[model samples]
Target: MASLAAGGVVIIGSKLIGGSWAMLFASGGFKVKHYDIEQEQIMNALENIRKELKRLEQADSLKGSLSAEQQPSLISGCSNITEAVEGAMHIQTLLPHQ
Candidate 1:
Protein backbone atom coordinates (compact mmCIF):
# COMPACT_ATOMS: atom_id res chain seq x y z
CA MET A 1 0.00 0.00 0.00
CA ALA A 2 1.18 3.48 -0.82
CA SER A 3 1.55 6.04 1.96
CA LEU A 4 -1.48 8.33 1.99
CA ALA A 5 -0.88 12.01 1.37
CA ALA A 6 -1.34 14.37 4.31
CA GLY A 7 -4.43 16.60 4.58
CA GLY A 8 -5.94 14.66 1.72
CA VAL A 9 -9.19 15.04 -0.21
CA VAL A 10 -12.71 15.70 1.03
CA ILE A 11 -15.77 14.79 -1.06
CA ILE A 12 -19.14 16.15 -0.02
CA GLY A 13 -22.67 14.88 -0.69
CA SER A 14 -21.72 11.19 -0.83
CA LYS A 15 -23.80 10.51 -3.92
CA LEU A 16 -22.77 8.54 -7.00
CA ILE A 17 -20.47 11.29 -8.29
CA GLY A 18 -19.09 12.03 -4.85
CA GLY A 19 -18.36 8.38 -4.24
CA SER A 20 -16.67 8.09 -7.62
CA TRP A 21 -14.47 11.08 -6.90
CA ALA A 22 -13.56 9.69 -3.47
CA MET A 23 -12.53 6.40 -5.05
CA LEU A 24 -10.45 8.23 -7.62
CA PHE A 25 -8.63 10.19 -4.95
CA ALA A 26 -8.08 7.15 -2.77
CA SER A 27 -6.59 5.24 -5.70
CA GLY A 28 -4.05 8.02 -5.98
CA GLY A 29 -2.90 7.48 -2.38
CA PHE A 30 -5.00 10.28 -0.86
CA LYS A 31 -7.01 9.77 2.27
CA VAL A 32 -10.57 10.69 1.23
CA LYS A 33 -13.27 11.83 3.61
CA HIS A 34 -16.80 11.36 2.25
CA TYR A 35 -19.39 13.60 3.83
CA ASP A 36 -23.17 13.58 3.72
CA ILE A 37 -25.86 15.06 5.90
CA GLU A 38 -27.37 11.69 6.65
CA GLN A 39 -25.32 9.07 8.44
CA GLU A 40 -27.07 6.25 6.59
CA GLN A 41 -26.25 7.80 3.24
CA ILE A 42 -22.63 8.13 4.18
CA MET A 43 -22.53 4.53 5.34
CA ASN A 44 -24.19 3.27 2.19
CA ALA A 45 -21.75 5.16 0.01
CA LEU A 46 -18.79 3.75 1.89
CA GLU A 47 -20.09 0.19 1.58
CA ASN A 48 -20.74 0.57 -2.13
CA ILE A 49 -17.36 2.14 -2.70
CA ARG A 50 -15.63 -0.74 -0.92
CA LYS A 51 -17.46 -3.37 -2.96
CA GLU A 52 -16.85 -1.54 -6.21
CA LEU A 53 -13.19 -1.08 -5.43
CA LYS A 54 -12.78 -4.81 -4.88
CA ARG A 55 -14.62 -5.64 -8.10
CA LEU A 56 -12.51 -3.17 -10.05
CA GLU A 57 -9.32 -4.60 -8.64
CA GLN A 58 -10.37 -8.11 -9.64
CA ALA A 59 -11.09 -6.86 -13.16
CA ASP A 60 -7.83 -4.91 -13.22
CA SER A 61 -9.77 -1.75 -13.86
CA LEU A 62 -9.20 0.14 -10.64
CA LYS A 63 -7.71 3.58 -11.17
CA GLY A 64 -4.27 4.73 -10.01
CA SER A 65 -1.80 2.39 -8.28
CA LEU A 66 -3.53 1.67 -5.00
CA SER A 67 -5.01 -1.80 -4.57
CA ALA A 68 -8.67 -2.32 -3.66
CA GLU A 69 -7.85 -3.12 -0.03
CA GLN A 70 -5.62 -0.09 0.20
CA GLN A 71 -8.11 2.24 -1.43
CA PRO A 72 -10.89 1.42 1.01
CA SER A 73 -8.55 1.97 3.88
CA LEU A 74 -7.89 5.46 2.59
CA ILE A 75 -11.57 6.28 2.24
CA SER A 76 -13.70 7.06 5.28
CA GLY A 77 -17.23 8.30 5.88
CA CYS A 78 -17.94 11.61 7.63
CA SER A 79 -21.23 13.09 8.76
CA ASN A 80 -19.87 16.39 10.02
CA ILE A 81 -19.06 18.82 7.26
CA THR A 82 -16.66 20.90 9.33
CA GLU A 83 -14.68 17.87 10.44
CA ALA A 84 -14.62 16.49 6.94
CA VAL A 85 -13.09 19.65 5.53
CA GLU A 86 -10.64 20.13 8.35
CA GLY A 87 -7.09 19.75 7.05
CA ALA A 88 -8.38 18.62 3.64
CA MET A 89 -6.14 19.61 0.78
CA HIS A 90 -8.87 19.46 -1.84
CA ILE A 91 -12.62 19.64 -1.46
CA GLN A 92 -15.17 18.57 -4.08
CA THR A 93 -18.90 18.90 -3.71
CA LEU A 94 -21.47 16.85 -5.67
CA LEU A 95 -25.17 17.29 -5.15
CA PRO A 96 -27.95 15.25 -6.70
CA HIS A 97 -29.86 16.69 -9.61
CA GLN A 98 -33.41 17.81 -9.03
Candidate 2:
Protein backbone atom coordinates (compact mmCIF):
# COMPACT_ATOMS: atom_id res chain seq x y z
CA MET A 1 0.00 0.00 0.00
CA ALA A 2 1.01 3.60 -0.56
CA SER A 3 2.26 5.66 2.37
CA LEU A 4 0.57 8.80 3.69
CA ALA A 5 3.17 11.42 2.91
CA ALA A 6 1.21 14.07 4.80
CA GLY A 7 2.08 12.15 7.99
CA GLY A 8 -0.30 10.58 10.55
CA VAL A 9 -0.61 8.15 13.46
CA VAL A 10 -0.42 4.38 13.72
CA ILE A 11 -2.14 2.32 16.42
CA ILE A 12 -0.26 -0.86 17.17
CA GLY A 13 -0.63 -3.89 19.41
CA SER A 14 1.50 -6.46 21.33
CA LYS A 15 4.09 -7.35 18.73
CA LEU A 16 7.38 -5.62 17.94
CA ILE A 17 6.25 -5.88 14.35
CA GLY A 18 3.77 -3.11 15.07
CA GLY A 19 6.55 -0.80 16.08
CA SER A 20 8.56 -2.04 13.15
CA TRP A 21 5.70 -1.03 10.91
CA ALA A 22 5.55 2.32 12.64
CA MET A 23 9.25 2.74 12.04
CA LEU A 24 8.76 2.11 8.36
CA PHE A 25 6.08 4.80 8.22
CA ALA A 26 8.06 7.23 10.31
CA SER A 27 11.10 6.64 8.15
CA GLY A 28 8.96 7.72 5.25
CA GLY A 29 8.55 11.11 6.97
CA PHE A 30 5.20 10.29 8.56
CA LYS A 31 4.71 11.05 12.23
CA VAL A 32 3.68 7.80 13.99
CA LYS A 33 2.11 7.09 17.35
CA HIS A 34 2.25 3.51 18.55
CA TYR A 35 -0.34 2.41 21.07
CA ASP A 36 -0.50 -0.75 23.12
CA ILE A 37 -2.97 -1.42 25.95
CA GLU A 38 -0.23 -2.96 28.05
CA GLN A 39 2.46 -0.67 29.40
CA GLU A 40 5.16 -3.29 29.04
CA GLN A 41 4.29 -3.81 25.42
CA ILE A 42 4.59 -0.07 24.80
CA MET A 43 8.05 -0.03 26.29
CA ASN A 44 9.05 -3.11 24.35
CA ALA A 45 7.74 -1.64 21.13
CA LEU A 46 9.72 1.54 21.56
CA GLU A 47 12.86 -0.39 22.24
CA ASN A 48 12.26 -2.59 19.26
CA ILE A 49 11.76 0.46 17.10
CA ARG A 50 15.05 1.90 18.28
CA LYS A 51 16.81 -1.32 17.42
CA GLU A 52 15.23 -1.32 13.99
CA LEU A 53 16.26 2.28 13.47
CA LYS A 54 19.82 1.39 14.31
CA ARG A 55 19.65 -1.45 11.84
CA LEU A 56 18.36 0.95 9.21
CA GLU A 57 21.16 3.37 9.94
CA GLN A 58 23.68 0.60 9.56
CA ALA A 59 22.10 -0.51 6.30
CA ASP A 60 21.48 3.06 5.12
CA SER A 61 17.75 2.63 4.38
CA LEU A 62 15.93 5.43 6.20
CA LYS A 63 13.68 7.73 4.23
CA GLY A 64 13.66 11.45 3.43
CA SER A 65 17.46 11.19 3.56
CA LEU A 66 17.36 12.15 7.21
CA SER A 67 20.52 12.63 9.20
CA ALA A 68 21.08 10.35 12.19
CA GLU A 69 19.81 13.01 14.60
CA GLN A 70 16.59 13.50 12.64
CA GLN A 71 15.54 9.84 12.75
CA PRO A 72 14.64 9.46 16.42
CA SER A 73 12.31 12.44 16.23
CA LEU A 74 9.93 10.68 13.87
CA ILE A 75 8.03 8.50 16.34
CA SER A 76 6.59 8.69 19.84
CA GLY A 77 4.65 6.47 22.26
CA CYS A 78 1.03 7.02 23.27
CA SER A 79 -0.46 5.94 26.58
CA ASN A 80 -4.09 6.46 25.72
CA ILE A 81 -6.28 5.91 22.70
CA THR A 82 -7.20 9.56 22.59
CA GLU A 83 -3.61 10.77 22.56
CA ALA A 84 -2.77 8.27 19.86
CA VAL A 85 -5.49 9.46 17.54
CA GLU A 86 -5.26 13.15 18.24
CA GLY A 87 -3.76 15.33 15.49
CA ALA A 88 -3.38 12.35 13.18
CA MET A 89 -4.62 12.91 9.69
CA HIS A 90 -4.87 9.17 9.10
CA ILE A 91 -5.06 6.22 11.46
CA GLN A 92 -3.66 2.76 10.69
CA THR A 93 -5.37 0.21 12.90
CA LEU A 94 -2.92 -2.69 13.26
CA LEU A 95 -5.21 -5.15 14.91
CA PRO A 96 -5.47 -8.57 13.31
CA HIS A 97 -8.72 -9.73 11.79
CA GLN A 98 -11.12 -11.57 13.99
Candidate 3:
Protein backbone atom coordinates (compact mmCIF):
# COMPACT_ATOMS: atom_id res chain seq x y z
CA MET A 1 0.00 0.00 0.00
CA ALA A 2 1.14 3.57 -0.69
CA SER A 3 2.39 5.32 2.40
CA LEU A 4 0.06 8.29 2.43
CA ALA A 5 1.17 11.75 3.48
CA ALA A 6 -0.08 13.29 6.72
CA GLY A 7 -3.06 15.16 5.30
CA GLY A 8 -3.69 13.33 2.01
CA VAL A 9 -5.67 14.88 -0.92
CA VAL A 10 -9.28 15.80 -1.56
CA ILE A 11 -10.97 16.71 -4.88
CA ILE A 12 -14.33 18.47 -4.74
CA GLY A 13 -15.74 17.27 -8.01
CA SER A 14 -16.39 14.08 -9.94
CA LYS A 15 -16.23 15.33 -13.48
CA LEU A 16 -13.54 14.57 -16.07
CA ILE A 17 -11.11 17.17 -14.78
CA GLY A 18 -11.65 16.10 -11.19
CA GLY A 19 -11.01 12.47 -12.10
CA SER A 20 -7.80 13.50 -13.81
CA TRP A 21 -6.60 15.29 -10.75
CA ALA A 22 -7.46 12.33 -8.57
CA MET A 23 -5.49 10.03 -10.85
CA LEU A 24 -2.45 12.28 -10.74
CA PHE A 25 -2.42 12.38 -6.96
CA ALA A 26 -3.10 8.68 -6.61
CA SER A 27 -0.29 7.96 -9.07
CA GLY A 28 2.02 9.81 -6.74
CA GLY A 29 0.89 7.45 -3.95
CA PHE A 30 -1.22 10.07 -2.19
CA LYS A 31 -4.61 8.97 -0.96
CA VAL A 32 -7.35 10.86 -2.86
CA LYS A 33 -10.95 11.45 -1.87
CA HIS A 34 -13.44 12.47 -4.55
CA TYR A 35 -16.16 14.65 -3.06
CA ASP A 36 -19.39 15.05 -4.95
CA ILE A 37 -22.95 15.84 -3.99
CA GLU A 38 -24.35 13.04 -6.15
CA GLN A 39 -23.45 9.50 -5.24
CA GLU A 40 -24.03 8.23 -8.75
CA GLN A 41 -21.55 10.71 -10.21
CA ILE A 42 -18.97 9.59 -7.71
CA MET A 43 -19.57 5.95 -8.64
CA ASN A 44 -19.27 6.72 -12.34
CA ALA A 45 -16.09 8.67 -11.76
CA LEU A 46 -14.57 5.78 -9.86
CA GLU A 47 -15.37 3.40 -12.68
CA ASN A 48 -13.93 5.80 -15.23
CA ILE A 49 -10.79 6.20 -13.19
CA ARG A 50 -10.27 2.46 -13.25
CA LYS A 51 -10.85 2.25 -16.96
CA GLU A 52 -8.57 5.18 -17.76
CA LEU A 53 -5.77 3.86 -15.59
CA LYS A 54 -5.99 0.46 -17.17
CA ARG A 55 -5.86 1.98 -20.60
CA LEU A 56 -2.84 4.01 -19.70
CA GLU A 57 -1.07 0.96 -18.32
CA GLN A 58 -1.80 -1.01 -21.44
CA ALA A 59 -0.32 1.79 -23.49
CA ASP A 60 2.78 1.93 -21.28
CA SER A 61 1.90 5.48 -20.32
CA LEU A 62 0.89 5.07 -16.73
CA LYS A 63 2.39 7.40 -14.15
CA GLY A 64 4.17 6.38 -10.93
CA SER A 65 6.00 3.16 -10.11
CA LEU A 66 2.85 1.46 -8.94
CA SER A 67 0.94 -0.47 -11.54
CA ALA A 68 -2.53 0.58 -12.60
CA GLU A 69 -3.80 -2.19 -10.39
CA GLN A 70 -2.24 -0.59 -7.35
CA GLN A 71 -3.35 3.00 -7.96
CA PRO A 72 -7.06 2.40 -7.50
CA SER A 73 -6.51 1.53 -3.88
CA LEU A 74 -5.29 5.06 -3.29
CA ILE A 75 -8.54 6.71 -4.32
CA SER A 76 -12.03 6.71 -2.81
CA GLY A 77 -15.40 8.35 -3.39
CA CYS A 78 -17.17 10.51 -0.82
CA SER A 79 -20.44 12.41 -0.66
CA ASN A 80 -19.72 14.55 2.37
CA ILE A 81 -17.52 17.47 1.36
CA THR A 82 -16.90 18.50 4.92
CA GLU A 83 -15.75 15.05 5.98
CA ALA A 84 -13.77 14.53 2.80
CA VAL A 85 -11.81 17.76 3.16
CA GLU A 86 -10.92 17.08 6.76
CA GLY A 87 -7.14 17.03 7.08
CA ALA A 88 -6.72 16.95 3.34
CA MET A 89 -3.27 18.06 2.26
CA HIS A 90 -4.65 19.52 -0.95
CA ILE A 91 -8.17 20.50 -1.96
CA GLN A 92 -9.31 21.32 -5.51
CA THR A 93 -12.67 22.58 -6.67
CA LEU A 94 -13.74 22.65 -10.31
CA LEU A 95 -16.55 24.86 -11.45
CA PRO A 96 -19.11 23.64 -13.89
CA HIS A 97 -18.83 24.78 -17.52
CA GLN A 98 -21.47 27.33 -18.22
Instruction: Give candidate 2's TM-score.
Output: 0.77
Q: Using TM-score, rank the candidates from best to worst.
A: 3, 1, 2
**Top TM-score hit:** 3
Instruction: For model 1, state the Cα shift of residue 75 in Å.
Output: 0.5
- Using Cα atoms with residue i matched to residue i, what is each candidate's TM-score against the true structure? 0.89, 0.77, 0.91
lDDT of each: 0.87, 0.71, 0.89
| Residue range 39-96, candidate 1, lDDT tens digits | 9999999999999999998998989876788789989988888899898888998987
Instruction: Indicate the residue-level lDDT of 56 in model 1.
Output: 94
Give a tens-digit lDDT track for model 2, residues 1-98: 33555657666673756776777676667777878888888778777777767777889876656654565577778878887887788776667679
- Which order, best to worst by lDDT? 3, 1, 2
Model 3 lowest lDDT segment of ten: 1-10
Q: Which candidate has the highest lDDT of all?
A: 3
